[model samples]
Target: MAPSATAHPLRGREQGNLPEDVSSFVGRSFEVKETRRLLSESRLVTLTGLGGVGKTRLALRVARDAQRTFTDGTWFVDLSELHDADQLAQAVASTLGLQDWSVRSPQSVLIDHLADRRTLLLLDNCEHLVGPVAALVQTLLRACLGLSVLATSREPLGIGGETVVRVPPLTVSAEPARAPAPADVPGGDAVALFEQRARAAVPGFRLTAENSATVARICARLEGLPLPIELAAARLRALSVDQLLERLDDRLRLLTRGDRTTPSRQQTLRLCIDWSYDLCTDREQRLWARLSVFAGSVALDAIEGVVADDGVDGDLLDVVTSLVDKSILIREEVDAAVRYRMLDTLREYGRQRLRDEGDPIALRRRHRDWYEDLVLRAQRDWIGSRQVERVSKLESEQSNLREAMEFCLGDPPSAASAMRIAAGLYEFWIVRGRFKEGRNWLDRALADGGPPTVERGEAMCVDSVLAALQQDTPAATVSAEEARQVAGRRLGPGRADTGDAAAVARR
Candidate 1:
């Protein structure tokens, strides 16, 4: 066979120019200038934001643009695939396109080479492996003044002198003009971007007077977030602009399938997240869905309580830790422990999946039981010899426990469980310093009662603490007295009767 026309002079270099992977980035001019300014002055410039906001694209653009400023060509290391921090330096060495270094650690070798040389290092997707990434960046900056790094992530490296730039979503244009009188609304980088991408899919797909307003409106609703807009634009083959708009109220459903022709993960904006979830095993998936119950971050012990099915097979901590490694869950380090979170976007996606997969009554019952058991344990432990230790443990789990209690009392599974969970966590409130949370739980347990008299009375005692915490003397007096009345009621000498008496006033 003769040499083909598609063949290049250099083998691998030809394929590197593909648009989806990394090329001369087309848009993102505003980010380029800020990145350049940071790279020139700071030891480290970390570009941070929600995923798919185009951090890697912007970083590459900055690196290519700044290559001439350094004698050493820019080095790029992508860390998304690396879960363990130990691999950080090896990955960096390989990405510098470095080959011969068997004598020492790759990082040491790279540092030795970097000592006398000046280069721009572009580290992409560092959020998943931040601890290792931060340590390495700090080490490099201390040992070598000649090196500059442009890192992209969902959060910042805590290396001192690190300049953090948050990448905001793309700008949107005026609403799409689907009406007879076309309005001229102003547009931004995101609007111009949507038109450019749409045109790529269909010839002559420009923003004309006929549909310009509606186009802008669509972009704005999607938050001018590039990945979603691109996914939306790619769907033009199957649906009209109007149809896309009509269906977007449920964005997860509307945006599942994407331009298979696009890229593997970025095919659909939703699929970007779906890929992360698909990468998890069954336990991880269940943990992720249950994690949606938390609106903000929660501690590991809390997760362990709510999701006891953790281990190599169903270990809660290990599963959550893996999700954190995969960047599906983000951790905020404070004191000695790590607090973990799912993004608002991701949390919503998990919630939708939970609703689809879980039985509502059953889920609520578990919610009630988990917190009920947890608070009972905390209360018992708090009254034990290790009161301080018990209080700290309860405090750690307070947020999720509070969430479960509120879930129980608000529209709880059974009024019986609701009353008990609220009454249970009430002592946890005093111990955990969650006065407001406990009071809220107590109030709901009482106000929404179809609960038994003993449960309701125990709930009153719980409210007394809440009222006392807030300096509401009248309510405190009322609830304490109410508790005494229920507690003093004589037992009927049966197990059931004793159960009511026990609830009315704990031993």
Candidate 2:
């Protein structure tokens, strides 16, 4: 386990900020220079960029460079999988041991304790939970006059006192069409990084006139990003650089190679992700592949909406929680709320497997029904503060929400399920200011005819409500009256549905 600051004292990725091997910092000289200046000038400095752009490495570089500026030495806090913002202070306190953070009010204890200490705080991976992390940062900076913080995130924390250092990908030169290896370009940064990664994969690998230009072009295509470069390099045992380049479309195979010696884990970046994936049983894999249908991070209950197996009744939450534990999925943080996400590369891997292994027709229908049903439930939960907690929980689980919706729009699942999910999300869509998305989904769902089911009436009712919300008062009145009339004729007076048909209509 890593030894960063956290409420429960994280057991992995936290044993320390990073390893002592300064072996991979081959090409980021410019980033290091400007980052040093930012740390020196600001109390809080955040290195922000897309995932795998070397933010963690840059932050570590700054901490190493800033070693002399601190009196108490530097402390690191890693919040990469932190799902709850309420746990932020406890996590910090747990790692710092500044006070008893195991209690319910760790933030107060943390503020009081940090008020007197002079130190450098290294907070890595702050993007997923910028709001809460930022809130904690604001509090800490306000109270701790002697503390300075250095963080890494994909985006800025947006706090008033924060100075954000935008970390771009490692440098790349244009690859000429059908490029040739340039033997004479000595000392280029791209060549250096490629040689460095290749050596890590195959001992003694180096740039020769024969492969130097080929190496350089591969790095350029990869944008000199370390993770992908390293992943590609790890395949050198079975692939020449050229062979690997040709197989870029099947990136999974290109990135992974046999490395049983490296703990059967951490063999390659692909292996690292795969170990996390394989640790999940078949069911988890199925759920993961289905969940990959979502883009970006999604809330928890979103899983409940999109992933129940059509062939059998399965426990969706248990499966999701299992993925989180295995590290195949990540629990994300929003201010006061926790969301979840699948890494982009992993999501791609899952989607392919989902298509290959799932029963296409059945899975599609199930996907539609589940999301359709879940959205209706979500709609009811959105209005009033009555189900705000549940609503947030839903938002957190689907980590792949955007992708899941795409699945709903195609073929057999279209129209009926789309209308139901769209109409149900109207209240939430409006409140969350998702104005355009709500209208799009509603319009798509209401476009034409739908399958006849117990859910039809409820879906129609939801459709009317959304129309009303969109300011069609007459449509709203007409739909509500139709719902009452339908209830009287179909359900009989005083024996009206408990809206159970809406639940079954999703069938």
Candidate 3:
């Protein structure tokens, strides 16, 4: 809900409650045109999509565009963080400049005041209380013939004669084979958007042929999703384009930089996804965390195997479908098999939830085990006719494998498991030319310095070989000597990493 009436003293009737845009509205020429056309034909129009897909922005743009058509005014009611359904009517009334002190109901005040006004109400973030919103909208439309409503939500209000428009991510160029010329940059909506936000973050930043490809790749990696793109662009204040792209694999952390003027929920990717996460039922929330184990799109069988446990005790398919309906999961088809996946930002949020509220170690171990068994199967079948299929399978699971290894390396007890997984991926690392990454993982696992074992020796040897291939002779020699020492005797454990104990001390 918005601030109290005193905080935002009632404005003149001409201003209404429409907020001025803090940043330029980027692409969506076609969306604006189509939405305006729909509003002309229908009294209720809903812009629906995933959170941070620019639904609110699009609705605002459309409302401002058609403002002159409404003789009374265009008022905006923000329901993004509002929880109390009973206050919904009062919130709308306040936004419409109504300050009735009588014992009359807020809904009654709104109806009587707007009965003859040709007003357009911009209802933002109505997904949480669709029932109340639908009822109120129905009442207003029935009473006020000149009234129109434009709503933004993850799903429809389910009202009769309502036009639902699904907003999509901005269009991004295909991954370029090579850096395109500056002429090609303006045509891509996502690239243009990043440039705009980047300029705001760093006034001197410009889209040049030299940096355009990196910007384009950044947008492509973010799937042309508006909020994430804006968040990424804001990082230009501290990070160069190359640094930004390299750090994007850990996007939830890197894209946290957001505009301060926006609401707290809109200030970071995690918070944006958190709003959606909070709206789910407990079962759906659990399923969401479990499904985050996968790296990319996952088949239903895999989802059921990983998520349909005792904790999530219901028809799993129904929960999956419900998540899709709520825009929490994206449903896709590959080779006639249906699969589901979360956006990278959403996946990271689910992973954070698993760490904060669930048994993250256990779930990550399960994820590792599942992928390990698949790797063994693929290795066994590599000699057969299905070798190509095996390659495809491993490639698809690459991110999952990396995530598993990351978890293993972090837990003290799982260092050996990390070494074993690193050993198993020797060939994959070579094929993908990821020698440096392979060496880094091996080095971390070996740093645990457990008792001398074959896994430790093998990991050291692999690290030595990778360092040699990279022409780091000193590191190669040191790693080779370490491998020999590991084969001979026990090693002292490394110091355990500390947390924010200092922060508590400071407080």
Write the residue-wise lDDT of candidate 1 on 1-507 in tens digits: 111212111223211221133212345677898789878889799998876787877877777778788765576765654544654676566445443212246567668767767777888778878888898889988888898888988889887898999987776645443423213225666666666667655766867676776677777766767766765665565567777666664443445444333222233456546645665687877778777776457777656655564322455667777676555676676456678877555777788878888554555556556667776776666566877666655545544554565565556446666667767766555433344445655666677535247777777777775565555557677777666655555333232223322332331
| Candidate 1 vs candidate 2, TM-score winner | 2
Regions more than 4 Å wrong, model 1: 1-26, 174-186, 250-507
Rank by lDDT (best first): 3, 1, 2
lDDT of each: 0.63, 0.60, 0.71
Q: TM-score, each model?
A: 0.47, 0.48, 0.49
Q: Rank the candidates by TM-score, best first.
A: 3, 2, 1
In angstroms, the error of model 2 at 482 is 49
**Residue 301's lDDT in candidate 3:** 66
lDDT of 3 by residue, 1-507 (tens): 111212122446555657667467887899999999999999999999877788988999999999899988898877754555766787677556565433356778788888888889999889989999999999999998999999998899998989999998888878542344344455377887888888876888887667877888887777777877776776676689998887664434445444333323334455435545665789988988878777667777666666666388778889998777555677776545576767655766777777778576676677777766666666556577877666656655655676677778677877778888886666655444455456657777787568778787777777766665555557767777676666555543442211121111222
In model 2, the worst 10-residue window by lDDT is: 1-10
Candidate 3 positional error at 175, Å: 6.7
